[model samples]
Structure formats: C-alpha cells, structure tokens
Target: MTANDRTKSTGSTDRTGSTSSAGTPGRPLTGRRPLAIVAAAAALAATALTATPAQARPAHASPPTALYTPPANPDAGRQILDLVRHRKLADAAGVLAMTATPQAVWYGGGTPDEVRASVRQTVVDAARHHALPVLALYDIPGRDCSQYSAGGAADTPQYEAWIDAVRAGIGSLPATVVLEPDSLALLPSDCGQDDARGSRTAERYTEIHYAVDALEPLAGTKVYLDAGHSGWHSVNDIVPRLLAGGVGDATGFFLNVSNYRSDSELAWYGKLISSCLSYVSAGGAAADCPNQWWAVNDAQAWLDAHVHAAPSAMKHFVTDTSRNGQGPWTPPSGVYSDPQDWCNPPGRGTGARPTLDTGDPLADAELWVKIPGESDGQCTRGTPGPNDPERGYQDPPAGKWFPQQALELVHNADPRLVP
Candidate 1:
C-alpha cells in the first residue's frame, strides 16, 4: 500500500470528503467504549475465555482460536497509560480505543532471520492481548517500483523464503495478511516498470502466486491479496490482476489498504468488485461490468440485472480507514510542479476505529492497515529537496512516526479525540 498513498487521479471524491458510518447504529465500530483501567483488564481476561474469531483457527497457538482482541500495551496504549499516570485522561482519548485493537504489522526490508524475529515478536505480543494480527507482506521482488518506499526481496527465491519465515512465525495463529500492494496495480507493463517482454511482471505474478500457496493454508489465517482501491483501477482491470496473482484461494482481496478513500466509496467499490468477480465466474464478460467510474444507480441496476451471487457467496474485503477523516487533499492551483497531495497531506485525520461489527456482512472488518502517525516519505511534490516545502519541514522517512503529524491526526480524528 506504500504507506496508503492514493493514486494520482482527480475525481468527485476530491471535492467531497469521506463519508464514514463508523458510529452509526448497528455498526458497533469497536468492542466496547472506554471503561476504567482495572475494569478494562478484567474485560480483556473475560474476553479471552469467551471471544471467538470471525473464522475458526487450526491447531496452533495456545487455546487454538480466539477473537481479535486489543493488546493492553500497544505503543499508543502505553502512551495513554503514561498520560493517566500523570493525572491526564488520555484513556478518555478515543485514540486509545483505536490503538488498543488489531492493526497490520508490516514486514519489509529485513533479512529472513530478522523478519522471522520481528514477525514472531509481533504475533506473540498481540497474542498476549488475545488479539489477532493483520500482517502486511510487502517484500516482493520489485516493491514500490523504486518509489518513496522502494525496497523488497532481491529475487523471487528470497521472497518465497521470506513468506515461509512469516508463516513459521505465525505458527497456526489467526492472521489477516495483506500481500504485496501496488505489485498488481502498477505492473512492469505500466509506467517506469520496464522489464523487457514483461518478464518481471510475470515473475511478480509467480511470486504472489507462490505467496498465496505458502500462506493461505495456515490454520485460520485470512489472506487478502491487494486490489488497490476504487480510485486506482476499474474492477475489471484489477480483477485480471487478482486472478493472475491468485485471489481464488485467498480469503478475498483488500481495497484502499493504507489508502484514504471514503468508507462509503470503499464499501461500494468492494461490493462491485465482488459482484464483478462473481459475474466473470458465471461466464459473463469482464467488459460488461461497470466500475468505480460508472454512475452509482447504473452500476447497481446492472448488477441487479446480471449478478446472481448472494452476499454470502461474494468475496469479503477490508478497507484502510487510518487517515481518511477528511478524505483526499486538494491543493491550490499551480502550487508546485506536482502537488503530491497524498504525501504527508497537511491536515488528514484518523478515520474510524478498528472493529469487527462494520454493519456490512461482506466487510469482514474495517481495519487500520496504515499506522496513523507514520510519515509517507519525503514528499517533494515535484521539487527536489529533503524538506517538503508543502509542509515547511523535513518529513520523517517512510515508516517512521511523525510526532507532529501524529498530533494532527489525533486532533482531527473523525469521531474526535477527547484528550
């Protein structure tokens, strides 16, 4: 997901902000609201005994399967604890609830042993809290295509080994794995990816297919391959990539992973993708399926006319709502050579909190795949310099938490943070 960067496209979404139904009735975006610290610990213990994952798990991890639970000691959790120790009410800060839940633990740019250790440490940590972990696998052969977050396995063999290590670390525990973002969307055939005869792109598919084979069979792990987001590709265009990269055996494909499209838009996009896939599976033409660019009424009516799959038969999906509170940024006219709006966008806030009850059956959950505080690399917006003039400061390197940006997100959160 390259730190959840939105594609470089202008659309109706650019004018209107995100429309989230996180706190709406029947949504129940989180397990519970703020409770006393002692009460929360008791609740956690009670949850472990009774909670069950949305899906069953295999014979691995102690007690086998448990529902996704929040670690009581996530960094943000600890930060809130420290605040409370000083008579502050950071616990009252809704960000605490968001931080307490399961989030994707990204593994990239590390040696096999290092990756194993990191993955093991993360899963073990989450297990202590009875929470399932969402692991993002991004160390593919040509990750990020030499862009801001560029770095991946040197070759396919190394990539396969990396996946093996991740699986070993998982060790029969439940996991939601987001495999390789942008690999399918921005293939070698597109843009700067210039592998001759498209061999690199072919290898990319091979690597992803190999990843699917290696990880999909693990006990209760739900593997969601990437389909970018609604703003990036038409459902028909990405459907081929998902199939080529092996989505049939996967739990489903994720949309807007680490990207900031609206929750409502993502829900619609995901439903359309699932319908189109079902349509194609039923011997229908991919060209006939309407995509995100299609008018809403026309697309829904078309699906009604042709799509025969029930909601249960359709593949499920998850959306990244980490920082889409205000949706995409629209820069001033001619502000720079390129207004890299997604890069460290000035005022984006955190979206819905992580939860299982997303109110939509097809949506297994609305996850926070992109960590809120992390910077999206040094965004020059087309000007070449270490400092991004757009923000008037040198942004942190990609994957590093930006305190200033973190504070911004906390302040601008959709539900609004109290502390």
Candidate 2:
C-alpha cells in the first residue's frame, strides 16, 4: 500500500503519532519470516469460526445491497475544491471529482463507542445519498510495524472490540471495506516481529480470517483482502498468502492499493494470480503457477494451459489506480544504496478515474484506494537528510497532501480527469 516507506514528527493524530519507524526501507521484501505455521493456520481457522464481530449483524435483516455512488458534493472533497476555488487552478478544476470520489473513511483510531458513532454516521450519510461507503478497517494490532502509517489496535482482543464497533456501526447498511492494507503484505515476522513459534503472523491471518468471515457474511458487504501489488509479489508467492489469509471467504482481493503500477501490468498480474489460485485449488502445487518474473506472453500462455476453472469459479479482484498512470519513478543509475522507488516518486500522475465498470470479466472495479496527493512518507531515498533528493524540500509526514505532487497528478492524468 506504499510507494515504499519512515520518521520523526508528531504524525497524524491517529495512532502511533510518529511519522518514522525503523524498516528495511527501499524495495519491499518478503523478509526472513518463515511461513512455518501450517499447523497453526488450521487452528486459526477454528478460532475464526468461533470468533464474533465487534458488533454483530442483526439476526433478521434483509437490507438491499449497496452500490457505489459519488456524492454531487463530497464532505472531504472540499480539500481539493478549495485549492481550485482559491488558487485559480482552472486547468485542473475538473479533477476535483477525482478527489471527491469517496476514497475511504479511515477508522484511524478511537474507542469502540467513538468508532461506532463515527462509522455509523459515515454509513448513514452515504446511505442517505445512495452512495456506497468505503470503510478502511485500519486499527489492527502491530499496524505498520511502528512505521510511518503505524498505529492499529493494540492487541487481538482490542482489535476485535474495535471491529465489533465497526460492525455495529454499519448495522444493516451495505459497505465496501478495504481490510487492513498492509496486514498480509507486511506481516509481523517480516519486520522482525517476535512471538511464540511463528505466532505473530499466524495471529494476523487469524485476525484477517475473522474479519472476512464476519464482514463477508453480512447481507451488503464486500471484503477485499490485501494482495500488495503486481510489482511486490509473484503470483505463486502471493496466492499462498491469499489462501492462507482466507481469500476464499472474501469477495476478492485488492491489488496495488497505494502504489504505482501500470493498469495493464496490474490487470495481467491479477489474472495470473487468479488463474494460479484456481490451479492450486484444483490440486496443482503453487510452485506450478506462472509468476510476475516470467515473460508476459509466457505467463498468459501458462495460465491458458493450466487453469481449468471457469471464470466465475475464480476469485474476483480490484485495482487501485490512485497514482499509477505514470508508473513508478526511476532514479539515475548508481546514485545511492537504496532508491525507495515507491515512496513519493516525482513526476507520477493519476491513473484511471475510479469506476466499477472495468471491462475485464474478472475485475470487479478500479478504485482510488490511496488518496491522491497524499505523501507516502518523507522519501529521503537513502541520502540521509531532511530533504528528498527527488524533491528538494523535505516532504510532509505521510498521509498529508503534497500539493506539488497533487498538481502534477491532475496535470498529467492519463485519460485526464474531466470532472
């Protein structure tokens, strides 16, 4: 969910309150964490089955499913609208709706009652407008590994309580939940997380399974598990993570949530992963699946030959086209030890506008999961100083808007945002 990821500053008023945290930095890694919890995974399933939501769905409720709809005017959309109104950014005015397209309502951090009140109000407002509510269920324990986006629920029980509040908040209404963006992508073990016998990662999967089982069963909710992105994980690599994290129980999984990767690549990568999943489900070894490192043509050819399941049997997926139109940034070669290419790469532009009308049969939608103009973090890129080498000034702490980047995204929009 990051372009890459760190440090210093009283971060967002949300959780950790720190903008930077220790990390491997630069390109993402699968880390040295062993997924040796096969036995524990089965046990996690048992726990999930017995688990209950923070707020239980009413036993009797036949509410109609909710569909996504954009408000004619968005409450948070004013951030960008104000930019246009005051700055006379006439050329980029039409792009206001892109910002207003109702990305997600982050549960950031709060007590259960407070969370319930806020979430209930968000859903109520969206329902009033017939718009689908996109809730980011963030606040899980060990969130962000104490990194820039740090701060989730303190522990499993606390998380469950918060989740219960979330469920209670939604009540009988329909919603789309971007369940914990990096939960699966960056597991505790990856960040040297310590627990008993691969227990931390196991708990994460358990927590995810719990949420999926709870949310997916609701009458009007779709839960999309995290798949990181095409650039991050191989099809074979991620399929296991997905399966382990309960993708079957989800409406589908999400890709490139807050990173930059071309739609063509993301779509192709998604198809391969989905196909590989079907292959494995039918008893093929995960190792037999084609991966991102394979040549594009060969990958497609592999899927054509091996995946036997009909399209409907395979899981569906969504892509975050938030800021990938220009793809990722490339630094001049031999510049530094690490080039965190994903974090706030300069010159990136907005990709396709958010829409549910993706023509691909398996793609459920293309969404703006990452709020456009938001900073990935203070992208030092290993130069070791306040200012980003890519951009002269030190960028703001993560999640805050980067006005120059935002303007660049609007100006260089691929199809060009026209209202």
Candidate 3:
C-alpha cells in the first residue's frame, strides 16, 4: 500500500504540536554532544587571542585568495553558492581539500549550538569570498535505520527544536539544506513487526513533517527531503511519505544521499517519484498512478522529456558523491554477517569530487552528502588501529578509511600507492 494509504488506514493523528525530548536512546557518546563540546573548546581556544608571535596576524590581513569559486555550471555553482552563503566553510573547503585525493569532512557531530555557530561563520566567510555553502542535515531520529550511528532527538519535539536552532543559525542566508538522510524511505516503521509498528509510524511522520515545516520556509534555503537509493523503496511507496512529511513545502527530494546507487539509477528513481508527485498533487490515486510502473531505457531521456528544470512549486534536489564511484559492493558470501553493508561495505572506493551539476534539468544539484574519511562505525574486519591488518578489524563504516582499503583504491586508481 502507498504510504498515504497506510497513514490514512492506520488512523494516525495529525502531528501538530507533537515534540520530542532532547535525550536519545543508546550510548551517551553516540549523538552530537561530544562533537559539540570539542567544537566549543576549539572556539574558546581560538578566542583566547594569546597566540605565539608567529600566529598573530593583523586584523587587516588580506582575505585568503577566494579559496573556492562556484563551478561554471548553474546547478553546480548554485550548490557551491548555497554552501558558501549558508556558512558551510569546512564543507566548502572539502570541495578543494579532496582534489588531490578524494576525501570529505562530515560536520554534524558537534553540539547543536556549536554546529550552528560554525555553519554560520562558515557562511559569513564564504560570502566574503564570493562562494556558496552546502549543508547536510543527517540527524533524523533512528538515523542510519537505527544501526550503530542510530541516535537522534529522544522524540520529534526535541528534533524540531534542534532543527529550529539550525534554522536560526542560517538566518537570512542563502543555503541549500539536504534534509535528514534516509529519514523518509529507510524508516523503521515497518521493522517493529507487531506491537511497535504503530508508535514507529507516528514517530516517523512527526519527525519528517516537522523537519520540512521548520527548514523549508527559511529564507534563501532549499531543503531536499531524503529518498532512499534506487534499490530500496518503489516510487509509489516513497511519494506518499514525501507528501505526508510535507514534500509540498520542500524544495524537492534528494536521492542517494549516502548510498552507492549509480547516477543512472538515481535519475530514474528521482524522475519516477517526481512524476508520481505530479499525479498526486493533481488528485490522482497514488495506488493507481500508472507512471510508477513505466519502463525506460535512458533515465536522462525520461527526465529530459518529463522533469522540470526546477519544480513548479517546491524547491529542488541535491545528491551526494562521497563514495559512489564504483557503485555498491557485492560480497561473494556473507559480507556483514548481518545487514552491516549499510555501515561500511568493503571494496568500496571514493566517487566523483562533490559537485552540483547533475547534467539533468530536473536535478537541482549534486553534492558530497557523505563526508569522506569520517568513520562510518566500527566493524569486524581488520586491526583496530588505523588500518592495521594484524588486528584484522575493518575501517569504521561509510566515509572512514581502512588504511589498507585506501591504499588498495589508490593503487588501483594510480599504481603509485603499491610500492
């Protein structure tokens, strides 16, 4: 059944004033606090101003040569501009930092306040340099489908407040906010089996709608709701969820935020949903939406014929390029032993440099939604220490690198790393 049908049939209440608590389930170190504290401490240290003679500089020091310039393509440039304007300087920095070797920095770990401040400052700095900023919002409750990185605001209310702080931080700035990754499609509403399903469903809608309501209206900000990879949810299944979660308010929906689905696959999936959305908005039954089953040989051609350069009403989408160059890894046998592939699958390498150009009119921008180099989470593979093979622990999941894995990719890409 369509998500809308499911919602209506379930008789879920309207999520008007529902709110979540600040506390999240799981370990204390799991959420954004540790990172926030670290950032706060760093800010404090930077402010002390008791620098060594060499570190001190004149207030009038010339701004560093505009470190980043938006790419020539409008879509790509717009993504860059959004990042710069919104104060995502470090993210902006990643566009260049990974030029030599593919890498990116994920920035949501810090405290809500500190992260908000850092993003604000980053935008201010980027504006000074005539650049744009791109921001990624990944803290959806039950994030990562409630896996290792699975902590979020205790409930929806707290999440709304946290989102408000983030929105306030971007006050009056031009930015692109890639809303909660995998929050829409990868939700656990269905995972709870018999008893827990009801509450999980309510929580999912509450959080999604709250986020859209809070972020979509921010001036100069474009919020793209996350749609899972092409392989996951069908168009019929995802579109209604988008609607319930306020897709109408969002700029558009984002696809393949952190997964390895190919551009061709993502484009197809995106267009399919976009069409379904058009039908739904027109008062058509989502279940009867035949567009969902349409076949196509070329995603670009399909998009070319049907998709708009930008949606008539909503904002638009932005995708990630953090680690999809080679697509998904298929294990010869049991890879994760339990569906751990979502964490940090083996043999995967970095993808294209994060850019905004999707080469399709309907696609708003392409970005590095996944911050490369950050740990996805600990896994069972190689040694525990920095890619040490003797320990046989693997790299942390997702953006992290197992030194050995990194070396393999580097050597494969350019024989230099193999000495």
Candidate 4:
C-alpha cells in the first residue's frame, strides 16, 4: 500500500554476494544456453528490419549487464519439496520455474554484527557463482509508515550504525543496492507522523543522504534511491526528493519496487523523470518539466523542445516488473470501502523476467524488486473481520509466501513461466 512494502511483512525476513566469475555483474542468470538462443533469434530478426528515423526518446544506450540470482525463498523451496515428496514432478517443476528467475534479496532488520556476517557470506557466495547480487536495503527508521510491514531502527543514530554495518559487509563487492524502497515517497510529514517542526521528515532525508554517501562511494556498489513508482509520484514530485536524497551522487533512482505498474507506464515515466532531472540540473524549473499526466504527444513534444541531454548524461533507472504482468487490479466499483488493490490482489501475475536488456536508455533493468508470490500483508478491506472478503481468507503477512498466489503468478505470468 505504501509504494510497495519493502520491509519483510510485520515480522518476515530474507541475504549477500560477491563479484564477477558470474560472467559480468548483473547479467541475466536465466542460463547461458537460453541467452544464446534468444540472441540468435534477435540477430536473425535484426537482418530483416527496415531503418527508421530516430525519434527524440530514450533508446537502448548501454550494453546489458548481468544481475545476480539469489536462492529462492523458503516458501518456494518448501512448495517444491512437498511436490517432490508427493511425486508431483510436473507441479514441482512449475514452481521451480517461478522461483528460478533472478530476483532481489531483501534485508530489513538485524543486529549490526549479524547483518554484517550475513551480507558478507552472501557476497562471498555470489562471488563463487560469478554473479552480481541485488540487495533491497529497507531498514530505515519509521519504515512502512509504521503499518503492516512496520519496524525499523529505533532512531537515526542506530539506523546509521546499521547502514555502516551493511557497508562493511558489502566491502568492495560488485553489487546493485536498492536503498530503502519507501524512504522518500512516504516521508513522516506525509504520514502525519512528523512534528510541527518537521523533525522526523528532516531526519528521514538525513538518513537517506547518509546512506547514499556511505554506499555509493564503495568501489563496486551501485546504490539506487527510491522514487516510488509511475503511479505514485510525478516526475516533478519525485525529482526534487531524489535530488534532496542524493540522487546526484547515487546510481540514479529505482521505480515500481514492490508495486504493480505496467512496463510501458514505467518506461515513459522513467524517461520523463530522467529528462526532467537533466533539465533541472541545467537551470530549468521542476514545475516546467513535462509530466506523465500530460497527453502522450504533448509530453513528447515538450521534451523535444526543452530537454536535450543524452541518455548517458542523465541518471538511469530500474523498474519492478515482479508482479505487474497483468498491470494493476481494478476492484468492482462500490464493492468494498477500500479495495486494497496493492495488497495481494487476485489474478496478478509476474511480469518480465529480471534483465539488464531493457532496450530503453533510461531504464537500466526490469527487476523483480518484489520476490514473486510474497504476500502484501493481510487485507481486511475496511471490514471488522480479520479475513479478506475478496479472498474469503486471511492473507499471509507481508513477506511470507502464499502457495496459491505463487501458482497464480506462474499460471498468469505474462510471457508464460513454464513454457
């Protein structure tokens, strides 16, 4: 509900990694054979293509890099194990297909020493595989607006020490770090949790800036700040936050983490934000930037006329396609007082597989920022009862796996997970 709950559900939890032997850091880990076949098909297709005029839009500007694939979550593993025990080999294979794809490893709460040890082991394991790991760092103070996926450090100093431990664990390993998913979008001031003096909001920014400063400086770590998603913050609204949160120094910002925004929407929005960031850095006003709310042609025209920075000159972004295969869920009008659309909506499927080959210059990758099949917390839908009326059952907490949801994601996967 709060721009993709990054923390493990109220109490749920999830790991580390090392450098290249994995090929190149962040490269797609969908197996070398599959990649080769796809490349051959693409090459064959390219031979028959006709030339077209270059439009003023974001195009693939960088070669694709590799992304690490951490082990599947316990739920996925358990599901597979049970299926195997029952001789449900086909079903077991199907679930394996769902979990085999590259996804982020989330880390929310842990003691400094514990986190450091865990992260160190993770990076080391990644190094052994010759892959690059994606880390979802989500232990900020006042996280999740203190909702279902609540809990973070008690205060700023404690938060800083935790971050310091994370840095120590990462060391000089090649990694892609997605810093605090909702850190920017759901500030204390916006949640009515800040004081009259806005001390909490100020502290939030300070924490974010501290993280960017700390993690971005590591030789092999590329740190990305949170910018919510296309549906939440407009280019104008989030650009200033990114700037304030140290996007200038970090590896740009990430979009759609743990949310369900479509690929096309995310691409367009990311381009606009990247272009606007450039425009603002060049002395243009944030309000003057073209926004996603504008008509498509109008926005494109605005960009052509006002922004001139190359993709290489602007900050790059990544998107969460983890569970947006069917786009957003639209509950029946006037059904429940609150639809809780973002909270474990039914029939939603996994989107694109994690890949650095996004083909859009501004989009660095389409990542599974939210592990597939993880619950978004129990949804009451404004009812007094504990069960979600939509599902007629109590949903699992934020980070726990739901077997039904897992199969739903597989069955409805946009490109078909098992075929």
* Best prediction by TM-score: 4
RMSD of each: 7.5, 13.6, 13.3, 11.3
lDDT agreement of model 2 with the native: 0.66
TM accuracy, model 2: 0.80
Q: Scored by Cα lDDT, where does model 1 land? A: 0.68
* Residue-wise C-alpha lDDT for candidate 4, range 365-387, written one tens digit per residue: 88887887677777776688598
TM-score list, all predictions: 0.81, 0.80, 0.66, 0.84
Question: 1-419, model 2: which lDDT tens digit per residue?
Answer: 23222111111111111111121112111333213222222233233234322342333244333434333223224334344334333332433534545465666689999998988877766666566767767776777777767777888888888888888888777788888877777777767785769898998998888888877887678889887777676777778888999998898888776677789988888888888888888889988888888988887788878887887889889887877887866667998555666667667677887777789988987887677766677767678768877777787677775666666676667877742
Candidate 1, superposed: residue stretches over 4 Å from native: 1-3, 10-98
User: Which lDDT values do the candidates have, in the order given?
Assistant: 0.68, 0.66, 0.50, 0.73
Ranking by lDDT: 4, 1, 2, 3
Q: Report residue 85 deviation for candidate 3 (angstroms).
A: 37
Residues forming the 10-long window of minimal summed lDDT in candidate 4: 15-24
lDDT of 1 by residue, 1-419 (tens): 36347454521011101111111111112334434643453444344345433333223445423334433323344444444443333332444544444556677768888887777766665566566677878787666666667778998888888988888888766678888766777676665566668888888889998889988998858888888787778888888888889888888888776567788888999998888888888888778889998999999899999998888888888887878887767778887877666677777778887776788978987877777666677666678876777666677677654555655666667967443
Error of model 2, residue 113, in angstroms = 1.4
Cα lDDT tens digits, model 3, 179-226, are: 766566655664442144467766777787787787778766677886
